[model samples]
Target: MKTWKIIVLAAIVVVIDQITKFIVVSTMQIQQQIVVIPNFFSLFFIRNTGAAFSLFEGAQWFFYLTTVIALCLFVYFIKEIGDLNIWTGIGLGMAVGGMFGNFIDRLLFGSVVDFFKFVFGGYNFAIFNVADIGLTVGIGLVVIGLIVSEMKKKKTVAE
Candidate 1:
């Protein structure tokens, strides 16, 4: 993908993530869940006071510290890219935007806005926001890009 296209896609991800967070914060109650389809999915709202999956629950400072470190790594990778492969670009874009998105929430609200929930058979998952989607997709893209690139290299060597 073109550099400009990658930039545009990143901006879109950031905008969508922020807008959804705003709606969730304004419309939903804390821990309030509305089942979207029986028990498989739902829209729930909550402020995550800790890092991923509320791992360090109640430790607000943990989030602040990690966010900075993550943001640093995120930027480091983006800046170091020698060539922009489509999937790699998408990966970096999603990662950078998502990191910034959650960073905004952390700085502004002291927590990340989370509203999507998934559940099944006595098990429930933590709520998440669009930023999480970007983060996840970013990771997936990077992994896939690495795998595909490696395969291409092997094919060329064989030929």
Candidate 2:
């Protein structure tokens, strides 16, 4: 993947994430619920001051530090790789974009705006946002890429 393409992909994720958040914030009140599918999913407005599932609530400085470190590591990893495959590039782009999306929220509002909610088997799942989706999918893609790369290397060695 080219550097420009990676940047463009990341920018697109950030833009979509921000736009969705803006729409939610502008139209919904805190704790508001808009059901899109009964007994399955809904948009539930809430601000999370911590990590996933609201863990370590209110540790803003810690989050800021960790985010910076992670981003730096990402840059280093990409550079070390020299050339990224499509999956790796797209994965990194989405991951970075998602991180920045939440980081921006933390900087501007002291919390991340989460609204997407899911329920399964009568248990409520963690409420998350677009950024979370990007991060999760991105990481999954990266993992798949790594596995495929390793498999290819092993096959070559055997041959």
Candidate 3:
């Protein structure tokens, strides 16, 4: 995939993520819950001051530093590995978009606005947002792409 296309994809993700967050923040109060699926899912508003699952709570500087480093690494990788495969490009783009989405929230509000909630069999999952979804799915795709690429290389070498 071309670099420009990847960038455009990333921009799309960012737009979608930010729009959803804006809507949630505008409509709901902190700690508010609007159940959508009874015992399964709901829109629950909360500001997370930490990383995933609320780890390292209130460590703003840590996140800022790490996000900057990660963004630099992403740029470096994209430049070093030009003309990426479709899966890898799309994955990287989504990950970048997601990272920036949360970064924007942190910069503006000092925390991430989270709303989506899930409960399965009495196990309450971590509350997350669209940015988290992009990050998770993008990383998963990247992993899968790498695995498939590696498998192809091994097959060619064995032939």
Error of model 3, residue 27, in angstroms: 0.7
How much lDDT does candidate 3 score? Answer: 0.91
- After superposing all C-alphas onto the true structure, candidate 2 shows an RMSD in angstroms of 0.9
Evaluate model 2: give its TM-score. 0.96
Estimate the TM-score of every prediction: 0.87, 0.96, 0.96
lDDT of 1 by residue, 1-111 (tens): 455666677788889999998888788889888888997999988888776678887777776787689877755665676566778888878876787788788889888
> Between the candidate structures 1 and 2, which one is better when assessed by lDDT?
2
Off by over 4 Å in 1: none
TM-score of 3: 0.96
Find the candidate with the highest lDDT and give its number. 3
What lDDT tens digits, residue by residue, belong to model 3 across residues 13-130? 9999999999999999999999999999999999999988999999999989998998898789889988777788888889889999999999999999999999999999999999
Q: Of 2 and 3, which scores higher on TM-score?
A: 2
Evaluated at residue 103, the lDDT of candidate 1 is: 79
In model 3, the Cα lDDT at residue 34 comes to 99
lDDT of 2 at 30: 99
Residue 111, model 1: lDDT of 83
